[model samples]
Target: MRLRNHEGTPVDPVPFLVVVGLTFMFVLSFGPLYGQALGAGLELSVGVSFALFLAVAFGSYYWQVWTARPETVGVVPASVRAVRLFYLMLVLAVLMIGLAIPLML
Candidate 1:
């Protein structure tokens, strides 16, 4: 499907792709994956990992919105908005689980 901003503005495909790419990469590189990789006295708690994930996601969202402006200043389809939120929340939940699993062990 398509992606939209919290403001219900439809995001262009290119910027959306870029945002997803960067967000996923950041999450993979510096989120729980990095923490787990430390594998010693450097283990991070789930709270810290989730917090970092939120920060990275927030920053990525804003940066993308700024980079892909103009048409993003308007409204989008309700279905599109709903889908975007659902997808984002699902991703966040998965990230939390992934982070927590590492710490649980």
Candidate 2:
């Protein structure tokens, strides 16, 4: 089934799924380090991770809607922006995970 945005345009779920999945993996991998870095406990780290996941999910949805608007049609397609955003997030996640690993040792 297809998802519809605010404009009622059909949205491809792939990009959103990829982003959410990456975010989930990142949280699982980095949540503990996040807590350690901030001097927080397990509970606080889990809470923060949950909040971050929600924020990313909603933020991506809104970003898709904004990019898919008719006014931005001539500039860049929403699909392209979604792909670019996915790669950007992937790079950032890798960097953060890598940085966290050294700290874990």
Report the lDDT tens digits of candidate 1 across residue range 1-105: 565656666666575556566566556555655555666233463446656667766676677653555564457878898899899879977976775675557
Worst ten-residue run, lDDT, model 2?
65-74
lDDT, each prediction? 0.63, 0.75
What is the TM-score of each predicted model, taking all chains together?
Answer: 0.41, 0.66
State which candidate has the highest lDDT. Answer: 2
lDDT of 2 at 77: 77
Off by over 4 Å in 2: 65-97
